[model samples]
Structure formats: structure tokens, C-alpha cells
Target: MASPHRSDDLHQGDPVEDPPASYEPVNSDDALPYDDYEAEHRPPPTLRLRLAPWDVISTALLLTLLVVLATATNWPWRLYGFLSDVCTGETCGLVPFGVDNYIYPVVWGGIGAAIAAAGVGPFVSLLKGWYMSFWPVLSLTILMVSSVVGDSLTLFSERYWH
Candidate 1:
């Protein structure tokens, strides 16, 4: 014979008490009286733009520095040359690009700014999750691409425009 106090016996055919009629669902998690939510009731917007403002600014500044470097201005080369003298006795290569000029310090300044901005991004709530990883990579890519493009433009201008 089966035991009356068995674990399954207690709930197998037990009657459940109905929820109190006075209780109304106040929160969104509770079942809604309506069939479904519509587009008008969609969730709040997220920050989804591919490039953030800071990334653009940093890339632009770096490209601008490249343009300045291509010029005949001797000050940038002299300054960077003086700074590089302490280390290798040669003018520091500001970027991997072959052109070396006063733009070295300015290029370095823009890179430092990008790094600092990327570092500070995590503290922001929206930037804490996926954005934290995405932003730094994007910033670096933008800077690198801008540098290459600037170099190409410089070469083109010298070859044809002059």
C-alpha cells in the first residue's frame, strides 16, 4: 500500500487557493491585462553610434598633427629632436609613418589623449559593459587609419598637386 504522507501525495491533487481579487499587478513584471506590448512602449534608447565624439576628436587631432608635420616648419622637428637626443641621439619617430618632424610631440600628445579617454570610459555607466572593450579598439583603429590616410594624402599632394 502507498503511504498517505508521501512527497508526491501532498501536491498531486491538492487544490490551490485563488489569489485575492483586490490585488492588482502594479509592476511591469506582473502579467498585464493587455495581450502584448507594442513598439510605442519599447525600451529606452542606448548609445549605439559607431564612433563616439572623443574618438573623432582624437583622430582629427592626430591627422592635423600629421599635416603640420608635412609642412616646412622646423620647430616641431627641433623640439622632438632635442627630446629624442636624451634617448637615441636621433629625432624620435612620432608615428610608424616615415615622415619625422615636430609633429612627433603633437602626435604623441594626441595618442596620450586617446589612451586617457579610453581609460576613463569604464567609469561611465553606458561605457562599462561592451563599450569598455569596443571604444579603446575603435579609438586606436581610427588613429592608425587617420595616420595612414594623412600619409597617403601627403604623398599624393607632393606627387601631383605640387
Candidate 2:
């Protein structure tokens, strides 16, 4: 049976954290146990996203990349299409926009990837208890795939499908 719990785990330690005198599980119809409350608000069910150190770092990285991409996609260099069009005999870096385009996309992509690997990936692992399954890698892959394919999909939809 799913174990009943006290709502005191929020204090961090043991499964049973109620006051010694009053730590009894609710009498079926009275006050609920601490575990019940915890289960109700658990970060997320197992095999799901879990916040972790990498998540924090990756989130920061993604945010930074977002900033860089936004910055480069504008004026002066217009680096949005830089890396995408690089070495393709097309005007990627300094032609359509400028020199900023050449380096901006790559930098932003790196940041985006890092954010996925570090932030989103780890959080998945954390939620799934990293050891329970392959959450870390799986989560990272999900984000990586999204970032990589998202660009192409956006372009295709806008240019061809739409």
C-alpha cells in the first residue's frame, strides 16, 4: 500500500517528525499526518523533473544565452543567422548583417546547449533521483533536441509550410 506520511519532512530529516507526544497519524478522520501533506506537495512525482545544482546553473546559462542572442540578433552585427549560414558560401557573418553575426550564434548556441545540459537535464535527473533511472541524460537530450530542431522547424514552418 502507498505509505502514509507525516507532513514534517519539510524540516528535512526523518519520515516521522511529529512532536513526540502528538506525533500520531491522524485518527483516520482527524488531522492528517505530515506525510500526507508532503505527498500532496512533493516537488513532483518520481520519474519527473527535479530541481538540482545543474538546473540552477543551466537556467543561468540559458538566460545568458537568451540575452546574447537577443543582443546579437539586433543592430551592429545581426548575428542571428551567422553560425547557421557559416561556410555555406552565403552571406552569414558580415554580409547580411555584420561581423557580430559570425560569433554571436555560436556563443548563444553554446549557452543554450549548456543550459539544457546543466539546468534542465539535471533537474530531470534530480526529480527521478538520478540513480533510479537515466533521467539526467534523457532530460538533457530532450532539451538538446529541442534547441537543435527548433531552429530548423521554425524556419521550415515559416518559409515552406506557412
TM-score of each: 0.28, 0.23
Q: After superposition, how far is residue 48 of candidate 2 from its true place, in Å?
A: 19
Worst 10 residues of 1 by lDDT: 85-94
For model 1, the superposed segments whose C-alpha errors exceed 4 Å read: 1-113, 125-131, 160-162
Model 2, 64-139: lDDT tens digits are 5554654665521432333353333343223333433334454555556645554455445456555322333443
lDDT of 2 at 131: 38
Candidate 2 CA-lDDT value:
0.47
**Residue 30, candidate 1: how far off, in angstroms?**
38
RMSD of each: 17.2, 13.7
lDDT of 1 by residue, 24-120 (tens): 7788587443324322233445554454667456545654554465365774454333333222224333333433332344456555655565555
Q: Specify the poorest-scoring 10-residue window by lDDT in model 2.
A: 153-162
Candidate 1 Cα deviation (angstroms), residue 27: 36
